[model samples]
Target: MLVFIDESGDPGFKVSKGSSPAFVLALVAFSDRAVSLEVQAAIDAVSKQLRVFPEFKFSKSRPEIRDAFFDAVLPFDFCIRAIAVQKERIQSGYLRSNKEAFYSFFVKSMLKFDNGLLKDARIVIDGSGERVFKQELSSYLRRHTEKGAIRSVRFSDSRNDRLVQLADMCTGAIARSYRDNRDDADRWRQMIKAKIEDVWDFR
Candidate 1:
């Protein structure tokens, strides 16, 4: 199995100071390698059509682009699994203060809590952030997750990794549903709702 993981929102507790109230960590998994390639070709076509120079990102793209992106990639077979955490619901001081700890814990939770779903899967995560953070997350997933559940984990630049970008777009759609201020919050996620296996609200 191939799993592409990406997150939307910062793992910060400063919600009152402009930080997002909720954070979403999502993974898009493909059980068949051929389907994965098909989706990659779809992404490539969308990129060419939209002239998305770097990569296709949900936040960076306009509504039309998002529409085109979802329209292009929705036909493929994939499973979306995600965890959305409301920071205010968290009481732990350590998790509240430590962003890395918070991110790693929930990521581990998302994969470990899977009831025999994931097995020996290769994971690819967005590596646009600090290299140290990616390196640590790679190790953390290996150590904290169930033994042999993850066959391998690697970091890839989102610019070059279209699959990771797909994960980002999926995560952005899930994160949008958690925001209270947006009127069209559920619109994007609903577009690809059929592909979603679960959107867990972590309490």
Candidate 2:
């Protein structure tokens, strides 16, 4: 199994000052390697058709392009699991102030809630933090997750991994649903709703 992880919104708790009101982490899982390749090929085809960059980022792409990207990939075989956290609802100071801790907490939370779906899965998270931090995160996940369920954990640049980009798009769709400004939040979501296995709201 292959799992791609990505996030939307900042982990900072200063929602009133400048932080995002909600933080979202999404996991995209592919049970078959052939289906994974098919999805990558579809993304490549869509990017070429739209005359855009090879990498499709949810935050950077235009609304129409975003819609097109989702439309292109919805037919593939994969499952999405996401966790949307309302920052305001979190009262724990440690979780609120510590970015890495908060990230590790939610990432583990999402995987744990998956039951045994992630067993023996290889996880690729969007490369963000420093090397040591990534190492720590990997260790933390392996130590806490179901025994032998996680085969390996690694980091990859989203620009280089189309599946990670897909996770970003999925995370963006879920995060937008919690935003008051995005009136068309459900539009992209509805298009791919059947593929979304779970969306946990942390309230």
* Number of the top lDDT candidate: 2
Model 2 Cα displacement at 175 (Å)? 0.7
How do the residues 48-76 of candidate 2 rate in per-residue lDDT, one tens digit apiece?
Answer: 99997768888788999988999899988
Query: lDDT per residue, candidate 1, 31-146, as tens digits?
Result: 99899999889999888887887898888888899899999989999999999998889999999998888888999999988767788999988875687888888898889888
- Model 2 root-mean-square deviation: 1.0
Candidate 1: pairs in clash? none
For each candidate in the order shown, give its overall lDDT on alpha carbons: 0.89, 0.90
- Model 1 misplaced regions, further than 4 Å: 128-132
Q: Any idea what lDDT model 1 has? A: 0.89
